[model samples]
Target chain A: MEIITSSKAMQERALQLKKQGYSIGFAPTMGFLHEGHLKLVTQSLQENDVSVMSIFVNPLQFGPNEDFEAYPRDVERDKKLAENAGVNILFLPERTEIYPNEPSFEINVKNRTGVLCGRSRPGHFNGVATILIKLFNIILPDHVYFGMKDAQQVAVVDSLIKDFNFPIELIPVETEREEDGLARSSRNVYLSDEERSQAPHLYKGLQKGSEAIKKGEVNPSSVIHIIENYIKTNTNGKIDYIEILSFPNLDTLEQIHGKIIIALAVKFSKARLIDNIILEIHS
Target chain B: MEIITSSKAMQERALQLKKQGYSIGFAPTMGFLHEGHLKLVTQSLQENDVSVMSIFVNPLQFGPNEDFEAYPRDVERDKKLAENAGVNILFLPERTEIYPNEPSFEINVKNRTGVLCGRSRPGHFNGVATILIKLFNIILPDHVYFGMKDAQQVAVVDSLIKDFNFPIELIPVETEREEDGLARSSRNVYLSDEERSQAPHLYKGLQKGSEAIKKGEVNPSSVIHIIENYIKTNTNGKIDYIEILSFPNLDTLEQIHGKIIIALAVKFSKARLIDNIILEIHS
Candidate 1:
């Protein structure tokens, strides 16, 4: 596998691949490869002649108070994991390379990103959209893989690609989980043992909400209340938000008509955890 | 020459050209097909194997009070002019196709766009940056051309392309002017016959500033005073802005070090006109 550190080098390599008629697939990540990241790489490899996995700990995506400094990173281990997952290229750009000076430009997706994670962390989605656009241009990937764990991110990126007419396909991979149903996240490492034990409650709460919707609950407020009450009783996790939004658009639903995404975010003593499930109404 | 009105058809044609080893050159314009736009297209034909020109009177770039509804457009005339200039494909996507809904996304450049015309028309650069990105993606040109009359716009776009790492090269064509020295623009149609006669004073003011800089005058206040006084005396035009700035960054210059751009804007009774000239100093 080829390893490149500069944007020019990556584009030159991508040009050569294009000359050979190879379809390129990209999986952009913030290093610290978990089972979740490997799943995306695996999916990318299956879809294209060449798979490129970029490990950039983007400083723009983190807020002033967020865990930018404390975010997990292990380059050697990530390289080994990506190689094993059949990635053809490992692009590890330095912070200066990704952002030469402070960025003077921004890409913002409205409405879909204004709720959920976007509410608490302002400018987060703008940062995501900006870096993603830069990466897409540098790599010229035919398809890009994103994890479903970042449901709002997927929606925002979808709208960005659509509105900008970026010539890339977006493929969303399902959330990778532990045996006990805790969603896999690099931040999960921050949890204490007791917090880890209680972390599964977030997913359990989502499952309960999905089950309630499966049982013909059409009202969004009632579903949100049930999920909120479940998390309050089962764990000491602080609720950030419990929202029942329409799938894809993420608009707040007055009545669940077609498909709805029930998303939740909770903060334990040690870490913040998020998870979601999509529900469809048959009638 | 092939004329395509749908974006999908144009992209497909561009991709086919790419596969067959053709270097794409693009010229994006708001279609009245003036001599200025033809100069850009003519340069594209000389430098590239295929030349694609897009004629889109982007509504996003016009302020609510600006002349969006009365903006001149003659498609049949534009087609003939493009063919005569040896353009290979003419892209004219409909307004609805380009803006399917109220655009939720905005691409904005900072620092550079806050002066001159941008001060009067809020959100104009945001709209320009957004539509240019869309056109760049759809056309996938090897080199894109813009007139240097919009010097601030060229600077902002140059910064954006570099910041985003777009693969296309930028070619800044010299401003095309009429015999009396008025820079050709679609908005020139808005000028009454008497107002049209006074339009050349904008260019005359730019020439006076450029000549002062050429004769070793580096004081910005002196340079601005000369141009403002010329415009104030020559025509009954309202001076919108007249400032001597560092060439590409558009920052206020304490002393002329290397390159300086002298820019001016004047509002006549019926139209707004802008012009500029770049002066390079050598040791």
Candidate 2:
């Protein structure tokens, strides 16, 4: 596989490959390869003539107090994992390569960024949106893969593509999970031995909430209480927020109708883990 | 020449043409074609295998109280002019076609939008930036043309292309003007006969400023005063603003040691006219 570190080189290579009639599939990520990221790479490889993986631990997406400096990075391990997943090209741009200077304009995400993890991490989605746009312009991929694990991000990207009329298609993959039902995440390394065991309860609470909604719990508050109580009683963790809102839009829903997402973030001793489940309500 | 009114059909046509190895050159404009718009179209035709023109009087660029409804539009005339200029495809998407829903995200231009016409008209460049991005995504042109008559816009677009790393090249064509030096503009139609006679002074002031700077005037304020005074005394027009700043960045300049732009706007009885000249300074 070819490894590209320069943004100009990546763009030029993309254009040449495109001219040769290749349908490029792109998977953009921060380094430290996990099962979830590998799943996206695997899908890209299956769907396109060429699969390109980009590993950028974007500084713009991290707030001043966030874990930008300590974000796990293993370029060597990521390179092997990506090649094993059948990636044709590996784009590893430095911060300067991505941003030659401080950007004069920003892609401000005005909607769907105020809920879930976005509430706690301000300017995070703006950074994500901006970097992805830059990547899209550089890659010119036929299809871009995004995991539903970052479901809010997926929603924001959906609005971006629709609003901006990007030619590329967005393929959202399902969240990969552990054997114990905990959603697979790189942050799983941040958990202590006790926190690791309690991580499974986060998903359990979401499952219980899903079961209640399926069993005719219509009021949003009553359903939220059941899930909140599950996490509070079963896990030694603090509930950051447990929210039930219209899927993707995150708009307030008075009743169980249309699509809805039950999402929550839990703060353990060493890590903050988030999980969610989407449901279709007809009643 | 093919005329496409549907945005989807236009995008699909552009893609098919591109896949057939045709290089597209795009010239986006508001209709009521003037010499300036024709110059951009002419350049696009000369540069690429296919020249595509889009005539959209974007409401997003006009303020709520501005001349959106009264903005001059002549599609029949514009169609003839574009074909005469060798345009292959003409995209004429209506406001509803371009914007099916109100955009959830806006491309706010924080840098160059605060000066010249942008100083008086807020959210104007943001609208221009937003619409151009959409058009670029749809057209996917290899090169896009813009007339430098609106110099600040050229600068804003410069930053946008660089910041976003758009694969398309920006070709800024020189401002096309009449023999009397009044820049060709559709708004020129709004000027009364008497007001039209006084309009040439706007470009004259730009010339006077350029001459003064070339004759060793290092102070920006002195050059600005020379132009502002000339416009105020020679024409029965109200001076909107006369200012000098670094080219593109629009940053405050303490001394004339680099590329600088002397730009001005004068509001006549029925129309507002703007002009500028870029100067390179030494010592």
In the range B1-283, model 1's lDDT, one tens digit per residue, is: 8888887777778777876778999999999989999999889989999999999999999999988888888999999999998889999999877888777787777758887777878889888998998899889999999999999889988988898999889999999999999998888988888888888988998888878878988788998999888888888888888877887888887887678788888887768888998878764
Tell how far residue B185 is off in model 1, in angstroms: 1.7
Candidate 2 per-residue lDDT, tens place, A1-283, comes to 8999999999999999888889999999997889999999889888999999999999999999878888888899999998888899999998999988888787788889888888988899999989988999999898999888788988999888888889889999999999999998888898998889888999999999899999999998998999999988889999998889998898877887789998998988767788889989897
**A194-229: candidate 1 lDDT, tens digit per residue:** 888888888898999888888888898888889899
- The true-versus-predicted C-alpha distance at residue B215 of model 1, in Å, is 1.9
Per-candidate Cα RMSD to the true structure, in Å, reads 1.4, 1.3
Candidate 1, which segments miss by more than 4 Å at Cα? Answer: none
Write model 2 residue lDDT over B169-188, tens digit each, in one string: 99999989999999998899
Clashing residue pair totals per candidate (backbone < 3 A): 0, 0
User: Which candidate number would show the highest DockQ if scored against the true structure?
Assistant: 2
- Which consecutive 10 residues in model 1 chain B have the weakest lDDT in total? B102-111
Fnat of each prediction, in sequence: 0.70, 0.88
